[model samples]
Target: MTLAWLCLMWVFLSATVATLPLRIQFIPGAILLVAGPVLIIVIGLQVGFVFSVIALAAYVSMFRNPLLFLLARLRGRKIEVPR
Candidate 1:
C-alpha cells in the first residue's frame, strides 16, 4: 500500500509539474528520472487504480463537466447498490 501510494504521488506530482512552466517542470522530471528507479528498487513502488479514480475526481472538480460527473456518479451508485 505504501509503495502504491508513493508511486501515485510521484506520477501525480510529475504530471502536475509537467503542466507548469518549463523551467519549473524540468527540475522535477530530472529528479524523477534519477530517483524513480531507486524508488522502484528500494521500495517496489507502483501506482494503484485508486490514484486514477482520484485523478478523475480532481479533473471533474476542476472542469465542472456535469455530464461526465453525472455519468461517473451514476456508475458509482450502480456499483454500490447493484440494482
Candidate 2:
C-alpha cells in the first residue's frame, strides 16, 4: 500500500521535473534516475515479482531515451544531448 503511493508520487514528481528546462532538470532528473532501481527492488521484495516487473516496465517507458543513451554509451557509441 505504502509502496503503491510512493510509486505514484514518484511518477508525478518525475513528470513535474520533466517539464523543467534541461539544465534545471539535470540534478533532480539524476536523482530520480538513480532512485528508480532502488525503489523497484525494495518494492519487489516487499510486494512481489509481478508488481516489480510492472513497475520496471513503467519506469523504462518513462525513461526510455535516457536508458537508450546509457546503453549506447556502454556499447561505446558516441552520443550527444541537446543543450
lDDT of 1 at 52: 51
Segments of candidate 2 deviating more than 4 angstroms: none
What local lDDT score does residue 8 receive in model 2, on the 0 to 100 scale?
80
Off by over 4 Å in 1: 43-83
**Residue range with the least summed lDDT across 10 consecutive positions in model 1:** 59-68
lDDT of 1 at 73: 90
Error of 2 at 6 (Å): 2.4
C-alpha lDDT score of every prediction, in listed order: 0.57, 0.91
Q: lDDT, candidate 2, residue 4?
A: 80
